[model samples]
Structures are given as C-alpha cells and as structure tokens.
Target: MKRLTITTLLAVALLSGCSSKEEVIPDVPPSNLYATAQTALQSGNWTSAIEQLEALDSRYPFGAYSDQVQLDLIYAYYKSDDLALGEATIERFLRLNPDHPQADWVVYMRGLTHMAQDRSFMHDMFNINRFDRDPTPSRQAFTDFKYLLERYPESEYGADAKARMIFLKNRLANYDLATADFYVRREAWIAAINRCQQVQRLYPDTEAARESLKLEKTAYEKLNLQKEVERTEKMMKLNPAK
Candidate 1:
C-alpha cells in the first residue's frame, strides 16, 4: 500500500509538469496585429487590414498596444474612406485617452476623415477635384493643429502641425470669402457683411484678409451704413497696397 501511494503521487507530479509544459502562450502581442494591419494597408488590402486591427482591439482590450492600436485604426479607417468607422474609432480613443501624448494627432486625423468625405458640387460639375464648402472639418483641423502648437511647442511634429493649420485656415477663409461673394452677387448686403466679418475675425492674417476687408466695405455701403463703410474703407486703405 505504501509503494502504491508513492507511485500515485509521482504520477500526479508528472501529469502536472506535462500540463504546465503544454500550456499555450499567445503567439502574438497586440502590437503585432497593428504591424500586420500596416502591412495590409500598404498592400492596399484595406478590408483585411481593418479586420486585423479590430482583432487587436477585441482580443487585447487592455493590452500594452491598446493606445497605439487605437490610433492606427483611425488611420486605417480613413485610408479606406470608412468615415463613420474612422469617426467612431476616434471618439472611442478620445474617451479612452483624452490626455494622451498624441491626442492632438488623433483630433487632426478625425477632421481629416471628414474632409476626405466632403466633396464640392463644382467638382462633380466640372470633373475636377474640388473641396466641399463645409468649413467645420477644416475648422476642427485648425483647432487641433493650433492645440498642438500651443500645448506642445517642442513636439517633433509641431512645425508640420502649424503648417497644416495655416493651410486649413486659408481654406476656411476662402470658403467664407466665396460665400460673401455669393451674397454680394445676390445683393444680400447683410449676409455679405456677416461673412466678411467671419473672415476678419477668424482669419485676420490670411490672404483673404485684405479682400475680406474690401468686401466688408462694399457690403456696408450697399446697406447704407455710412460710418461703418468709411471705417472699413479707411482700414483697407491703410493696408499695404496688395
């Protein structure tokens, strides 16, 4: 009986060792999924790329790669023109990492997703690539870039962010100018003046500045605002002859 009990204990220990040795560790880290997605994206296999990324999110909810994966997923969705998915991914990332180091980049990418979706009617009409009149996305892009500049001045991407902000600001100012011109053509002095004021308030240093001031002067004159018209005209005259 003693011999049998000892043999049974030895057998159990052997079984335990075999079980431990056979235990399967996960073959990949969550970051590996992101890397795979990147490869797929570069290959233009957008569907597969997104699937791999989503898998990373699902399988490793709190893994070390979560934040980075979330960011990359946003880009993947945007590259594929999956605007709704891109927006949703960004919203989720914001919820998770509101104070993340790269939060500004996330915000900028979100706006970019919307900008990508937006298209101009003129583009369709003329078979040319034109942008939409929607200033909201461009405005958001500017805000994101502005935040990066102000909060992380020493950031590696700071200069690029500022440059993009300038571009977006100019685009937004152009939209305002275009709308003001449309109002002028229709003899809508109040609307024209309001639009010009928008450019002055929102984009004072942009190329649209001088032209916007000129439009404001014409609008005030059309509305019979004598003093306001004279004030705007004086300002325009003082502006370097451009």
Candidate 2:
C-alpha cells in the first residue's frame, strides 16, 4: 500500500508539472502583448504575430484594440495563406460590426482573399492553363467585389474592385469558351454553340464574347445551318477579336 501511494503521488506531480509548462501565454499587460504582435507583424513573422494577437484579443476583447486586433489577425491569416481562418474572421467581423466605418475596406479584403485563393501555384510554375480548374474562387471574388461597388460606390476601393470585376468577367467567359472549344473538337456542334451563346449572353462586352462569335460561326457551319452561320459572321465583324 505504501509503495502504491508513493507511485500515485509521483505521477500526480509529473502531470502537474506538464500542465504548468503548457501555459505559454505571458502574464503581461495587454498593451505589451499588442506591441509584441505589432513587432512580429512588422518583421513578417506571421505565426508569432497570430499567437500574440490572439492572446490580446481573448484577454481584452472590449479593450481599445479589439477592432484593430480582428483586422490585423485577418491580414495575418492572409499573409500566412491560412485562407479558411481568414474568411471566417472576415465573416465574424462583418456580422458583429456591420456598420463599422472600415466595413468597405474589410469587404475589399475579402474579395482580395478570394482572388488570392483562385490563383493556382502549379499552373503558374508549369505554364499550364488555370482557367481549366474550378473557378469557384473567382466566382466568389467577383460577387464580393460587385457587392462592394453596390454598397459603397464612393469607397476608395471602388475603382480597383471594378477593374478586378472586369478581369473576373473575362476569366469566366474564357472558361466557357474553352469548354466550347472542347465540344467543337469532339464534333458536338450544338454543345459548342450553347456554350458560345452563354458567353455572348452573359459577358457580351468581354473580349471572350468576341471570341465566342468565332466559335459560334464554326459550330453553325458544322451543323449545316447556313443562315445562322451568316448571322454569327456579321456579329464577328461587328466585334472583331483583338
């Protein structure tokens, strides 16, 4: 009984010591914690910055630095390529601070984050076509930027969002044209024409829209639709591809 009691006490003491060491957060002032986070951010130590900022946020959520903490954390998540956490942080911020003066800026950051996720590293390194991949990120980014424009027309990010929207529009339309090209190569003229018409209907002013016209002409010719071919030829003349 004596030996068993001693062993139990030793095990309890070892467990206590391990638990004490796991309390890694410093017992310091919130100001000091925030300063440490700032230093980490300035030095591009994203993981360290996240730890310090999260500590400050948890300890003093209603303190003077609460809002800024959330913003900084979101930026840190983006820089570290922790996209899921960044998106969640942005959503929480907007949900709680819907009328914040910096709401537009937050919205802009969300759009930027989505666009960042849309880029494919393999495509960039291998010179492969990124448009062939799933475009859900691009679609989400386009929607986000569109919302930014509609909600805050005078926002500083308005012009940039508009430009990105245009690029996204072309990207989406080009994807459709690429699929249409595949159908044409397979001799599926109707499928090819359907894809071309989709591009023309939705992104009529895009460069992809002009390219779609050429595909439409080819698909019509293959289908033996002479009059439709003539119509597509006239539309191609009106909006020639550059």
Question: Using alpha carbons, what is the TM-score of model 2?
Answer: 0.87
The digit string of per-residue lDDT tens for model 1 on 2-53 reads 9999999999999999987555323477667778878987898888888887
Clashes of each: 0, 0
Residue pairs clashing, model 1? none
Candidate 1 has its poorest 10 consecutive residues by lDDT at 21-30
Residue range 139-211, candidate 2, lDDT tens digits? 9999999999999999999999999999999889888988888899999999999999999999999888899
Query: Best-fitting candidate, measured by TM-score?
Result: 2
Per-model root-mean-square deviation over C-alphas? 13.4, 4.2
In candidate 2, how many Å is residue 213 off? 1.5
Q: After superposition, how far is residue 70 of candidate 2 from its true place, in Å?
A: 0.6
